[model samples]
Target: MEETSKLQAEAKPMIYPSNGKAKEALINEKQPEVRPVRGSALRQVLVAFVANIGTINTGMVFGFSAVAIPQMQMPNSTLPIDEDQASWIASLSSISTPIGCLLSGWMMDALGRRVALLLVEVPLLVGWLLIATAHNLPLLYAGRLFVGFGSGLVGAPARVYTAEATQPHLRGMLSALASLGVSFGVLLMYALGAALPSWRHGAGVSAAVPLVALVLAAVAAPETPSWLIAHGRPKEARCSLARLRGDVCDIDGELDQLTRGTSISAGDGKSRSDMAASKRQTEKPEPLIKTLFKKSSLWPLGILVAYFVIYQFSGVNAVTFYAVEVIRAAGIGGGDSDYLTAVAMGVVRLAATAAACILMRRMGRRPLTLISSIGCGVTMLGLAGSLAYLEPGDFSILSWLPIVCIFGFTITSTLGYLVVPWVMIGEVYPARVRGTLGGLTTCAAHLSVFAVVKTFPYLQHLLTRPGAFCFYGCVSLLGSIFFATLLPETKGRTLQEIEDYFTGVTPTLGPPKENKKKIKSKELNGSVPV
Candidate 1:
């Protein structure tokens, strides 16, 4: 009885707004009513599928370079590419990716989530259409560049939209769709590359993919409730949440949390800090540029950027993009049979990524990531040793070694390295800065792709193919150590909870009466916070 009396005495009203209008809205306005779905997974699936469509388009475009490079170098090619041109063709996508990423953040925030995704579809369609009809290298390069732009654009939106739209239970698997879509797209392109008469024919047919994504996104998908609320449309946020939940009651709790934590350091009185510290942190709005430079913000960015750097530098791109060459160098098939090997590798990647979707929810992010990095490191090193130590011509018995190594790299890399970085990128940041950081991370990812792809030939020349694999193995092993030590466990927490962790706030707290009374007294004193 005394505890209840003390708790009531200690309770204090917190004024969340800095201005009169917001204060009036919170105090006087009633929440809009809406219905929600109970135990229905449809809304989650639809949003994920819509976001996945953009990723699929991105994947197809990315995979386009891998298969089309071979055809462009063939004799009688309409736009035959030289060694230098082929390298550029492979690397050009990386060059244009950051531009796309920049646009993605703008479109997502300025226009809308749906609008940003629609923008992704248009460039992919046009890029492929141009590729199909192009008679010269310039047109071909331009088309490839456009496809890359579309791909880069999808990266930011996919992470932001999926994270915003789905519940915490589904976040890991759904967000993983971003990476999975890319894997499937690569698989799709490989399938088409094998079955079609030519690369041009395959690309021409693949243009239909984004066209479908465009229609579905325009007609069916809804903007996320979180995005709507952040943009100051609470009524719309309610409506979207209702549709997303579909007959579930009491959705207001989540809606309220979403509204409160819209910024990076949402300094409501519930935080672990003292009332003075809370007031000081939220007193003045931090500028975006200033926020980017702060140690707290920069630390997460560093982790995300390094994750992607490790993902690309683990030699995944070098192995996948130059699969045929690697196999040939290792004395697999004499001529073009390595194309078949590339296709098989794509299937393996798709399957492994799909498996990761299920396993991530059960086992959590950190464990799977550690396993993937270490496993890939070991496989790449084995490939290196076999190539460096054995004579290709004399060791006919070990011709299968390269195939085994490539398959091993594909399976191990996809299990964690290919998928987990995107998942972490989605989960680790505050919503206020998610779009900006996402763009920066995407830029880092593509830049690394360019770096590894452009330099692989040189590295192979300097250290031989075996030594190149050895170097990549070293990178993978080092990355594994970082993953084990640095990454946080975010398997089942809500977005608001994750954001609080970054802000040094605990998800759960119990305030002592003395501390609560002290805070209440501070607020009642009415001094302007610094």
Candidate 2:
């Protein structure tokens, strides 16, 4: 333990490319240590507001493609397209996410969050421009692919930025804000699709929102302090800490904590000279894949993947994609049925996710997830019953019942499942492996989405609507069981604390065993508490 303390004391921080540049700039300025400003609450709110713009932009682009596919079909119009070709417009975007995630992980580590975000925004702007002026099928597909790539790039960084910027206690609530942004974006898309007569206009409007968000993100957002520290710009990292916390009373202490918390000591059998040389020459190792294989990480990864798979398997994409067909099958006669259901689901999701923002902090993650999983399962079963038993053209019972089930599923989903799983992925891993592991888990989640969205129509045709819902119901129940058995509670714990829990490492809650001597001296000298 004494040896470990000495090594930690001598440890040098890792520096990324941007950190060196920032330090060079700071040398010429001679800036004072940045003090935390007043009105931290207001600043936090503003940061969340700006960060959510990225989330909203992502959802808007995703939702627009769903709304556009049927309109682009244009029945009997002889555009020389088949179902698979139309489906590619949406699938291409989903497939691009893993690639974008891999790239974003590298960029976030190298360039800092703000610059990485700017890179994502550039693609979105160009993609939206292409989408707005898409004259043919190829251009439309290209536009969708670019937009999807941009959205995927934003996902990991947006979460990382939001989580790193907030206080420990506030992390869950603030992190859930990204989900709220997605909900609102989806709602906006549904509303626009209903309100507009032309699909082109809806696509154009979707393209415009992200272009506007790109401008806002570029001008206003600050780089994450954690990213700053990782790059070796300790002074700028301190300034960023001050800006986010808005308090100076314990700024140095807080910085010390953050620095110590993130630092990784070189392993046994390495002399200090060798370690120092290694640090100077080598990049920070990416341990993400190896970490995922650990017994500690494997269970969480499984639970999270199951959560994502089940969430998608709830027939969300199938329903969203075929809302018009489902409504008609349910005996709803109006042409507006699809739009109405889409708008309703979006509204309910927004409200439920907003409620989750409040409840997740208060109620904790597990209970909310359990309730959502069970609720969605039961609701799906009910929908299957309605589909199987309801007589044809029984509009009163058929129309309202399925609509209620859809709303129930959407509401339950937002309350815990979708956003919380992503937040847990960010929280569970060590900083060394967080990005890569998170990306891998996210890839699994999204690949399930791609599979479901692409195949659900075929499944429905093969098994009928009732049979598909029954399958969804069974999968949801299994997910609930998985959550009950495997998912750990993460509320109110620091990242280190959560890491310790997963790794089966018992944390010293009080002073270190060897710190007793220092503790006595500090008390004798009237120094502040450790």
Candidate 3:
């Protein structure tokens, strides 16, 4: 209670808009030129873009198997694969992604966000190059593992950085931008798969993306102010916040808010014993078991685990890794191969994600997720029904029905379950455990992906297409109910507010509320600002 009150008191200077007038009055006396700055939001976008550019490569890492595995199955192909080998090839990256997620969690806090962002490109570049030149199963396996590891490394830092750097109003859009980058990357790979003669050439071309992301991170991205302050570098934190917010924002006041929000104290005039106690408190690490059991850590982790399980088992990844196979099974192209249809589905997913970025700015996370979950369930069931009943030579009549269901599944999944989980990853956890818990959440998610992707073929064989999709539909519907019950609405809430809700410091997870007592007290004193 004492800690929460201290945090609230520290946060009061910046959480409400009343401070704006005082800051404006102070700025007016200094310089008129610095009073207004345009495009602060644009600066936030630039940082977000840099942080997430690597996700495009992560997308390609996922989409690669969808395109590459089909090509490897060709009879005349130089590197051919049987069914077992193909499943391994398709699911290998997912197997190694958890390792990357675990490592980046430590590195995001131990090293820095910028360093993690920059270093992830190394494994990605090496992996793609290995795949491009691979001639055997071992080499292909090695490449996929490396790519998956790099993909894991990206989730923590990109979302964490974007969440900490941007303001509350712009945070959703920027954080969702990571998902948008992924959608674009998947679309790019699908188009490349359709156009390129060989998967090897596509791998070669994909190497350039991480290289570009590396350069962007090195040249443009700033270390998040929250990180800098937490690490005891207030000066750098001020500068970073300045760079992210531009001249119009009150960098000092925002920094103070950030300090309070992150639960770090300034320690201004404390005695030697007090300072020593504070140092001991902050430096002493909690046991992993205890940390995991804490309400702050446990609650958000539960939410994420439930959300990610739904995300993977709902067959989004099954469809992603096996787009061509799904399309073929749907009887599209009259029993012929069709990469273009996969590319078109990619286009639809990309467009839907783009819309999600806009809608995330306006809608609550819970509603969007519920809508997406329900939509995905309906689409999957629809596809199952269409696949079960459609007869041969019915291409002219209801052939497009299965395709429409598939497209509908893609659209609905992308809007909420696919994107919201990632956004919430950066939002829900408290700063003390954000890195560790974020990594674990991401690690668990990829493990689920691995299970889904690896077992997809077996599931299909055992149950047939309609039965498998029917299972997925049922799971998705149940998942919607789970999310609807527990998922708190996080739209327009600050990170501190969200953290407080999870910790039970506050009863609600809505937007920050003004201190009405303070305003009333000031009004009684006749000193309240107009």
Highest-TM-score candidate: 3
> Which tens-of-lDDT digit does each residue in 1-530 have in candidate 3?
99999999998875543777877876666653322212288899988999999999878987988898888898888999988898999899999999999998888878888999999899999999999999998999999999999999998889998998887778898899889888888889988998999999999999999999999899999998888987889999988888887856556656776765532111234533234335544675666557667998899999998899997999999999898888888877632347888889899999999999989989868888998889999999999999899886685667789988999999999999878999999999877678878899999999999999999999989999799999999999999889988998888777876876787766776322344455345324532111
State every prediction's TM-score relative to the real structure: 0.84, 0.80, 0.86
For residue 202, model 1's alpha carbon misses the true position, in angstroms, by 1.4
Q: Which 10 successive residues of model 2 have the least lDDT summed?
A: 262-271
Best by lDDT: 3
- Model 3 spans > 4 angstroms off: 1-39, 262-292, 334-337, 511-530
What is each predicted model's overall lDDT from 0 to 1?
0.76, 0.70, 0.84
TM-score, model 3 to reference: 0.86
Q: Which ten residues in a row have the lowest lDDT in candidate 1?
A: 521-530
Residue 418 of model 3 has an lDDT of: 75
User: Candidate 2, TM-score vs. the true structure?
Assistant: 0.80
Off by over 4 Å in 2: 1-39, 75-82, 262-299, 395-399, 507-530
Return the clash pairs for model 1, or none.
Answer: 36-246, 36-247, 36-248, 37-245, 37-246, 37-247, 37-248
